[model samples]
Target: MTSIVTIARLGAQADGIADAPGGQIFVPFTLPGERVNVAVSGKKADIVALLDPSPLRVTPPCRHFGDCGGCSIQHLEQQAYRDWKRQNLIDALRARGIEIEVDALVECPPHSRRRAALTARKTEKGLLLGFNAALSHRIVDLEECPVMLPSIVEQLDMLRGLGLLVAQTKEPFRMAVTQSASGLDVATDDSGALEGPARQAAVEYCIANGIARLSVDGEIIVEPKKPVIMIDGVAVIPPPGAFLQAVENAEHVMAKLVVEHLRKAKRVADLFSGIGTFALRLARQSEVHAAEGDAPALAALDRGFRYGDGLKRVTIEKRDLFRRPLTYKELDLKFDGLVFDPPRAGAEDQARQIARSTVQRVAAVSCNPITLARDLSILIEGGYVLKRVVPVDQFLWSSHLETVALLEKPKKRR
Candidate 1:
């Protein structure tokens, strides 16, 4: 039965929050302050039919709206979406007892920055080729994706063809597409666990269709392997499946911020320094020790540093910061600064250790703001003062917020 409901507020997932007679219901595709007749679907009532739409709800730029799971806020105007993201970050931090003045949200140029993406496998009907449907495992056939870089969008047809071939073979596959200024890289997985003959066929199709630089199961199958992307005019070849920041331009901004923050210090320790993005750049101005858990990424960073001229000031260390905290004896030499970029979980033990360390300045880059706020509180309670919190909107149209914070130890009392 279809029910008429009034949306109350916006939820974290960009769904409209509405109060039902039973309880609070989240309706997708319905904006706040809108009265709509919706048919419920699944456990949490989804808006099946919108009898009335909100004025704030505008036509999404992408034709794949309401289907593609990648973007939820496309129905909102661009400026409004940006404003909402900024407020979401502020509110999230406030809920954690941290106050932030989000005066200027760093804007990301649409369709300009994404470097790596994973597309979904196509079904037997040969329609969907991008991402799974919203809140469902069924793939949504995509004709176009507005958020992707222009180059990637152009290759959609080829990708669809590959997906169809894979589907016919009854093999599951995951396609990793990475693009840079130099060219595109298409990686296929034919391991039978994911995608088998279909993946192999995809690579063959790419080669036959003039797609260069392909990798299957982390090994290059075609073209001499090289970094297809350059950062600040410096070519950086990331290790296979190594963690590179998915957004290209945002990475540049993040690296610049971290490097600028570390420039004032004489010695710095970069934790979780994937491919030495921050460590290498900061080494130009100061000595840096790049510590990472992944050996392959660390090896690639070391190799890159060997050929680079400006980053001679950097050193490399392979350590899992999560498994064990850095002890005083381990860091016998006091560092002037510490730059850490941990995964989504944030650096809890590492942050605690830094709070106790002799480092005067700390720069923390986090992919999750909630964890960032919690970790920041720990540092604050540990005698460190929060100077500034800069929020970077790396993942647009999504609730995810990336932030960089600068912290300093309090001056000792006389």
Candidate 2:
């Protein structure tokens, strides 16, 4: 049934929420204070007509904005869009009962995302490669993507050809492509099992197209050139399908915040350090001990540290922090500064351990504000003061955000 409802606000998922007699209804692609006629079905609604448009609503740049699942909130005006994202962080912190002044949102420009995991499938007519539809498994073929680097988007046909060559099963698979210094590094996961002929075709395709590296299900198929990502003048070769910051500019912003905050410390420990994005930069001044669960990533960090010139002492440890977070007893007040950049789940166990320690300075980098706030709350409860929080818009037009939070513990009383 079609119903007209006034949008109350944008929810956590960037969907317009409307209060009705039954319950709250979520309408996608609508804005607050706007009246929209939607076809309702069990708390989910599709916009049948836009009755009253919001002043903050702007025409989305991409033609595939609503169809493609890669971006959200592209319709919001620039200033309003930024404020909405910044408010997301504030709301999350407030939910945790921790109130503090959040720094302004750092906006990453369009066509800045260097890494993307796109879905691919072989239809009866031809090969389909692009992001999946929002809340659906169906793939939306991309004519143009405003969020991804043009270099990556320009090679869509090439990627599709490669996908057609590698994909063996009828089901959909994932192709994770990253724009490295060498070239585009393509890695496939959940693709059909690679038989002998399929593997041979994949190798030939990578060599013929000059792909930097091609890996199938974490196994390297062929590497024309080592995929190297330069971090602050240091070149590091990450493992196949390794973790990397989505936006280069945002990475620099976060690193600068971390390095400046820990400038005075003589020694620092980097937890969950992936390929030493911060460790190598920090080693320029302070002695850095980088620990991470991925052995290959740690090895890569150590290699970069060893080869790089004019850096302080840098060490590495391959330890699973989730299983055995560096304990307070283990920490033993050894380091004055610490920097941790964990995954989306947000290092809860590690945060608890860090809270009980005597670390004077800390820089917490997270992609999820809710978990970041939760971790910050734990630190604050343990006597650490929340110094500053900066929301970074790395994944532009999407609900995802990155934050760099600096915290400090006061000196002990005599």
Evaluated with TM-score, which candidate comes out highest?
2
Candidate 2, run of 10 with poorest lDDT? 327-336
Off by over 4 Å in 2: none
Note the Cα lDDT for every prediction shown: 0.73, 0.93
Report the lDDT tens digits of candidate 1 across residue range 1-414: 678888988887788888887788878777888887777654266666676677778888888787788788878766777777777767767877777565466767678645545555545566356776676766666677766788888888876675465443344566677774546676656523225666566657766766556666777655534644555545567765567776877788788877776677888888999887787778777888889899878887777777777654678889999988675445537578888999999889887787766677888898887788878887887787778777777787767777788888866778
TM-score (all chains, Cα) for each model: 0.89, 0.98
Best by lDDT: 2
Which pairs clash inside model 1?
128-141, 172-194, 172-195, 173-195
In angstroms, how far off is 261's CA in candidate 1? 1.8
TM match of model 1 to true structure: 0.89
RMSD of 2: 1.1
> lDDT per residue, candidate 2, 1-414, as tens digits?
999999999987799999999999999999999999999999999999999999999999999999899997899999988999999999999999988999999999999999999999998887899999999999999878999999999999999999998898889999999999999899999887787988899889888988999988988889999999998899998888899999999999999999999999999999999999999999998999899999989999988888898999998889999898998766646788999999989989999999999999999999999899999999999889999999999989988999999999998999
